[model samples]
Target: MTGTTPTAWQQRIDTLLHALADARRDAAAAQAREVALLAEAVEIAQAMAQDAGGPTSVADIPMRSLAAQIGAAARVSDRTVQKHMSDAVVLVERFPATFATWAAGDISRGHVRVVVDAGVGIDDNAARAVFEDAALEVARRETPGRLKPAARLLATRLHLVPLQERHTAAATKREVWVRDLDDGMAELIAILPAAIAHGIRDRLDQYARRVIDARDTTDTRPTDARRISEVRADVFADLLLTGHASPDVSNDAIPADEAIIARVQVTVPALTAVGADDTPAELIGKGPIDTATALRLAGTATGWDRVLTHPVTGTVLAIDRYRPSDHLKRTLRVRDEHCRFPGCRIPTYRSDIDHTTAREHDGPTELTNLAHLCRRHHTLKHHSAWRVRQTPDGILHWTSPTGRHYPEHPARTLVFTTEQAGADIQTGAVSESATASDPPPS
Candidate 1:
């Protein structure tokens, strides 16, 4: 009924496969002849894929359906089926032409998936090419069994380099701290290389995600040197489990040495309870405090809530203005080890504190309202509507001026670039050499 005709190669392979099926059917009916060749044919097909730089095992499949199919056909367990399928893949790669002919139109999505999975072993382009070419040749020939030797021989001739396995001693140790904003927090020091700092931040992101994703939303995890606030509980219970928490006195909340001014929340009744002689310290953003001012604050307010300087200043830059209870300084250090703005990689602990919402707008000084944007990003946010906000679910939402939103996850992959002496000297830091390298996915 159909006018369309199949390609010559397709038709030929289809016929061979049909014949093989018929033979298997006959064997099943008679129950006298061996069906080993049916399995051998499938094995040969898989080998050809491997030889052609495709997957040869069931592990490649996120859902190992191929292994299931093999198990069903062989009347074996799924694991057993996978083993045979893997062997078949290896064999087919060795004998390309034979396996290629039978698989002409059988390259279904599942088949492709299996092939890709098996090819994980083949890293180099040249070796992958050999496997690919062999698969094509076998598909054209539709040959099986004897063809496997060719793939094995091809693999032998090829210089298959072993993949790298490095032990990074650097990741074994980590140092994080939280303290008051001292002169060190303001005065600059030698900064780490941006790329290196980014790599470290990426690694930390990976660690946090693995643990954090498991936790339910609405619950926040503590970051910074004060993560130990839970071990001792001077902070609130609900705030303890939240992603943001305040530091305890033992955990770097040192005594105020300089009579530096800060804001405090006082109860209205409590303020009135204070004696007439009681005088409060100078109010931050407001002028100095006297008995009259204290009495006024005590009378007007239920309790006193003001900012005070902590003795220590190890990691924290400053307390957020609006959300005094929440730690905005530490959030930046954890979210972006360096600046989140593109290209600039200033360490967050060293960077300036920025408000996602302007002081003019009533943005709270919470983790949601603050980001550890580097100086460049701080300027960009001030000048441009390139908005950066954190979702309650702990994701950075960056919207362009055009109103396009991009949700960015922390980078996890590490890229190592080496320079080779050549005509193309792209960057000054590292030479862009086409070395035999296969860095993992970023």
Candidate 2:
């Protein structure tokens, strides 16, 4: 009976392991099939390009036509199609052995990507072939994470250029990027040289240690103090802006009496701004932030632009700006919050407030007639088949040349009027509909 029970448990464990292995195989098979399809698409694109003029120049390739066809068929964006096409060309033409290995489920798509990324800019086909051979072998034996650094090192060695030269060349590509994350936060990434990057990190760490030491000795703070990471981040920002270790630091070098005005736009509900409500505020470029942080920031604000918005509809009612143009711009900024173009999220402040119906055609300059469009979208609107119309409610309805329709609603603020608050208190239920008919809050 004991032997039978042990055998049964072993069988179940084996079954689960087999299932996971099958899933991995299935995923690999799918990737292989996708690569095959991409290869075919690339062939068709090349054939079309040749038929267009039999031209010798890269510019002669009808990329737009190819991208459009692939995008439509695959239900992907043009940029995505372009990437797929590039990958297809590289896999089928440049790394056939690696492609075969990937198709056979011996290596993952990630492994393939690492190899391809490493092989880029290698003009000599023989050198690329050698690099691919070594990289593929490394990929087959190692995880993608382990293979990437190995592949990169192989590429550098194969390049035949000095390491310092490569480092200098790569340093030119250093950049800073901001990626919006979930939960109203953002990731600010800085790609810099190793020396500079390490220096910055070490400096932040030093400041963080100082903060920890200061809190321990001078303040009766709880054991659950701000984390080392949090302190370091705050210190980094403080040093960058005010040249101080902390915001409260007052010394001969840096005076705490001087105000540090943060130049950031935050759209808060009128009631929340006045402490009547606890509704969250929308930090421009970021998403919704908590009301406490919003209130704290608002309290320290050096200047203010009072924007009155309808409590129910969340529509901009009026802007109290000193300049007429500034008022118009603020009204549009509050109304749009982002570019009105479909799927575009460029902040309204960075976007151009365009007249949907042209001024030459006698379009009014009212909020209803104006639309916020990024520079690229504005040019596309004028030149391409993208048409935009703003409804009375400020919702933008877009019509593509293919007759596809997309609607972009106005950015809504979360604010409850006195009547809506009263309704919630009486019924013990809260909903947007309860406030839909309510007058704007004072």
If scored against the real structure, what TM-score would every candidate get? 0.24, 0.46
Q: Write the per-residue lDDT of candidate 1 for residues 1-442, one digit (tens) a residue.
A: 2554445545665677678867654543332112234355455555555565645464355324656765677788978765655555553554343234234343222333333333435656656565545434432222222223223322322324311111122233434445557776532132332223433344334333323333323244345333332232322222335533233322322223411111231211122234421112222111122333334444443222222211111122222234333344433443344455543445554366666676678887776666566677788878865777766533467776545565642211011111211123233322110001111112
Residue lDDT tens for model 2, 294-350: 455556554456665554445565665443445566567666766877656666655
* Winning candidate number (lDDT): 2
Total backbone collisions for each predicted model: 59, 0
Supply candidate 1's per-residue lDDT for 42.
57
Candidate 2 segments whose C-alpha is farther than 4 A from its true place: 1-10, 54-63, 172-189, 198-220, 223-232, 242-244, 247-442
Model 2 misses residue 214 by how many Å?
Answer: 11
Quick one: best TM-score, which candidate?
A: 2
Candidate 2, residue 171: Cα displacement in angstroms equals: 3.2
Where does model 1 exceed 4 Å of error?
Answer: 1-328, 342-344, 410-442
